[model samples]
Target: MSIIQINLTIAQMLDYTMPILFAALCGVLSESAGVVNIGLDGIMRFGAFFGLLGAFFSHSPWIGLLFGIAIGCLVGALHAFITIRWNGDQTVSGVAINVIAVGLMTYLLEYVFSTTGYSPQIQNYFGAQAYRVHLPFLAKIPLLGAFSNLSFMIWFGFICTVLMHVLLYHTVLGLRIRTCGENPKAATTLGINVFRIRWFAVIVGAALAGIGGATLSISSFSGFSDSMPNGVGFIGLAAMIFGKWTPFGALGAALLFGTGQIVQSIIAVTGIAPKLAPGLTLILPYVLTLAVLAGFVGKSIAPAADGLPYYKEQR
Candidate 1:
């Protein structure tokens, strides 16, 4: 391919990477804190629905973002209450969230809009908004210019990645959280409230995951659809695992996965092995996920107490 085409592909890959990256970070945050959050899809649904609702009514995307985060946190809190406070099975709780989200969001959509699949389009400042940000200077650069323009949420996702890395590795709260995940009994002895820490992590993680969903409906496309999330949540979890549960690592994995998803489109447009590309693109990420897990199973160890209930007297 030509340099121009390569740059365009990179830009497109980045466009798709934001949502997955944000969602994967949710998994990283949850698992790192000893809770399993497989319900990112559910949380994202809440975000997309509420975000569109807020934006549609107010014609302001910023307000829509707030709504998304709020709803995501609510779902995350519910998940936390089930798994942390009730000492429920984390995986079961997560699965329940996903099921509930699908059913609830679908029913609510039909009720509110009298339509089943998607909501009415939201109006915005750009006359109908495209969820992209085109930077001036970088837009003029040569080979690197393609990297400059992107969805605003992509930049937000990048910022979140940096902040998450700092929060997990550098901050006192992060250290406490890691201790809670690794050895809750020890953390409790050190005066850390394991329950609260887990709750905080789950809630924050959910909110972050909401950004992933909002990216779909608001930042990438300007409306909410029942199927907008489209399994990206599950993909995010696989990315988290493949990245060894680190923020920077998850970013890399997400980029790879995003590229895989966009491959079919690229080849279709470029007319490069159109027949084989479709099949390969569809199965690529999953194949990579399985391969990564198989190759790294013993090498990639999770937090010691991950997914384990932390009862005060467990030790």
Candidate 2:
């Protein structure tokens, strides 16, 4: 392909990768602190609609972003309460959240916006030319040209990746969180509040998932659709597994998935989708995710206490 084409493809890959990256990051954070959050997708859905609602009503995407994060925290807290506090089944709680999100969001869409398909188009930062960061000097630099003009979230995603890596590896808090995941009993003996750490992880992770959802409605598109996340959250979990639960690993996995998505789109645009069956073409990203998981999930090891409920009293 030509240089321009390569640049455009790279840019599109980053655009598509943002949500999955955020979701994977969410999974990494939660699981690293001994919580399994299968409801990341549901949290994204909640963030998507609420983010749009805030942006639509306030005419400011920033407010919408906050709305998404707030809802994510609330839902994350619910998950933490059930699993960490009450020692409920983490998987079941996650599944319940997903079910509730689907039904509730559909109902809210119809009730609030009078449409079940999608919300009305709103002023969004994602698509506006004014919101993009333009670096004209970088435009002619081959692969780097992709960075010439891009959404702020795209940059933020990369920054978050670095920050997460620092948080998980270079900081004392990171060490403590990892310790909680590996051995909550040990963490407790060291004066660390296991429940509190898990709570913080889940809530922050969910907030990031909320941002991922907002990226869909406000960054990648102008409004929220019934299928806002469209399985991106689950794919993110796949990315998390494939990445072995590391921030930079998640970033790489997300980019790989994003590449699959962009390739599918390119096939469609290049008149190859019809010849190859459009349905099959659309499944490329998922197929890639499964393939990666099949090869990596078995080899990857999780934290020792991950998904286990710790009752301090038992200790």
Candidate 3:
């Protein structure tokens, strides 16, 4: 590709990547704390839905974002209550959340909106305009400038990644969370609150996921649609696994997946191989996901008691 073409591709990739990056960050927080958040998909769905709803009602996107975060926290709490408090199976709880979100969103869309599966276009929406950052000499750079001029969500995701890395590796709270995940028995013996740590992590992770979803609805799409998150949550999960539960690694994986998605869209627009394009583009992310999983399955190690529920009597 020519220089301009390459720059454009990079720009497109950056624009498309913010949501996945945010979701991956959320996964990192939850899984690192030994809470397997399979319900990330559901969390994203509710975030997007409520975000749009809030924007529609309030006529302000920022308010919608807050609303979305609130909704995410509520869902996260429910997940925590089931998985941690009740000692329910994490995988099952996650799956249940996903199923519930899908059905609930569909019902609201059809019944409340009187639409099949999408809400009517609301004039008041978030991210309706491009947000440009003019960095004196930096904006003149060829590819760098193109990639650097990112949306608000992109910048937020990057900052969250740094913050998460620091929090996971630096703070005493981080140590406690890690200990709980790695060795609940030991953590309990040391007077650390294992359930509380897991609950905190799970809720925080859900909030981040909600923010990610809100970004997509308010900033990326500027509207609400049933099942709008598509499979981005699943993609984030794949990224978390591929990154070995590290923020930077997950960011890299999110970028890779995002770039693949942009490339697929570009190919579809070109209409070169129209017949095969749809199927090929749709499977690209999953193909990459499989590749990553296969590549690291044996080499990568998860937290010691990742999916197991802790019980004092069992120990």
Alpha carbon lDDT of residue 186, candidate 2?
A: 91
Error at 210, model 3, angstroms: 0.6
lDDT by residue (134-252, candidate 1, tens digit) is 67688666778776666677788889999999999999999988898899999999999999999999999999888788777887677888896889888888889878889998999
Task: Give the clashing residue pairs of candidate 3, or none.
Answer: none
In candidate 2, which residue ranges exceed 4 Å CA deviation? 269-274, 278-298
Name the candidate that leads on lDDT: 2
Model 1 misplaced regions, further than 4 Å? 1-7, 125-131, 296-298
Q: Tens digit of lDDT per residue, candidate 2, span 137-214?
A: 998888999899998889989998999999999998899999999999999999999989999999999999999999
Q: What TM-score, over all chains together, does every model reach?
A: 0.93, 0.93, 0.90
lDDT of 3 by residue, 1-315 (tens): 555666667766776677787778878888878889989988999998888888878888778889889999999999999999999999999999999999998887787678886677766554444344445465567777664455566677888999999999999998888888888899999998899999999998899999988887887777778767998889888778777788998898888888777766666656555555556665766776666667643444678878889897675
Q: List the residue pairs that clash in candidate 2.
A: none
Worst 10 residues of 2 by lDDT: 272-281
Relative to the true structure, how large is the alpha-carbon lDDT of every model? 0.84, 0.89, 0.81
Clash totals for all models, in order?
Answer: 0, 0, 0
